[model samples]
Target: MEVLLSLVVGALVAAAIYLMLSRDLLRFLFGLILISNAANLSIFVSGRLISGAPPLIEKGQDFPVGEVANALPQALVLTAIVIGFGLFAFALVLTLRAYRSLGTLDTDEMRVAEPKDPS
Candidate 1:
């Protein structure tokens, strides 16, 4: 399972990079989302994938009886997910506004700093 997850993460990262290299702003935003997710998945996999027991102790027990899942990675992933969502939302809105104002979603053509040749 870990090997499979590693493969999946690798694929996602590859796809994200491919999308990020596109000339389209929207594609770059999508790549950002994909890469964030890939990072979360990588963190999750690094924490280990155990199916033994939950990360909770019984009422009488001071510690868990068997192997328990790590809570740190889960918490980290959750936090990352929320933050990523917010960032993605903001970027999407910003991109839409830029597209509307600039009349183009292509990164090269949306350049306002570099004026086009009059000729």
Candidate 2:
């Protein structure tokens, strides 16, 4: 299980990095989201995997919580999701503006927005 989890995290991180390197803004946005999810998964897995154990502790019970999931990672993931959504929306709007200004989705051509003033 540990090996599998490590492999999965590695794959996700690699793919996310690859996508982020692409010139397309949309792909970059997606890559950012993917990376965030991968990070969340990595943190969750670091806490160890447990099955069939409840997350909440019983009232008045002094015993330590069972080998269930830690809530911190879950909360962090939720926060990341919201942040990702906001970032994606902003990126989409920026992409739209870029498309409107350049009249093309290709990032390379947009680099030459103004003619080089070689006086």
Candidate 3:
């Protein structure tokens, strides 16, 4: 199961990289989302895919009675997902503003600081 998940993460990363390399800001935003998801999945898979009990201990015990699933990775991934969503939303707004002001989504064409060629 971990192997399969790893493969999926790899594929996502590859696709994300391809999209990130494009000149379009929207494509780059999509790639950023893909990469964020890939990171979350990778973190989840690394937490050891065990299915037994929740990480709660008995009243008399110091730890879980049986094989409990790891909670740290789950928590980390959840937090990361929230953060990633926030970041994506901010980036999307920035992209929209850039498009509205620059009249284009192409990074190469949005060079406001660069002087235009006379030719």
Clashing pairs in 2: none
For each candidate, give its TM-score against the true structure.
0.91, 0.77, 0.96
lDDT of each: 0.95, 0.80, 0.97
- lDDT tens digits, residue span 38-96, model 2: 88788778766767465766889765475765667667778878887897788889889
Residue 55, candidate 3: Cα error in Å is 0.7
- In the order shown, the candidates' Cα RMSDs to the true structure are 1.7, 2.7, 0.9
Cα lDDT over the full model 2? 0.80
Higher-scoring candidate on lDDT, 2 or 3: 3
Taking the tens digit of each residue's C-alpha lDDT, what string does model 1 give over 1-111? Answer: 999999999999999999999999999999999999999999999999987678788999988888888999999999999999999999999999998899999998987
User: How many clashes show up per model?
Assistant: 0, 0, 0
Q: Candidate 3: where is the Cα deviation over 4 Å?
A: none
lDDT of 3 by residue, 50-117 (tens): 99788898889887887889999999999999999999999999999999999999999998999999
What order do candidates take by TM-score, descending? 3, 1, 2
Best candidate, lDDT: 3
Clashing pairs in 3: none
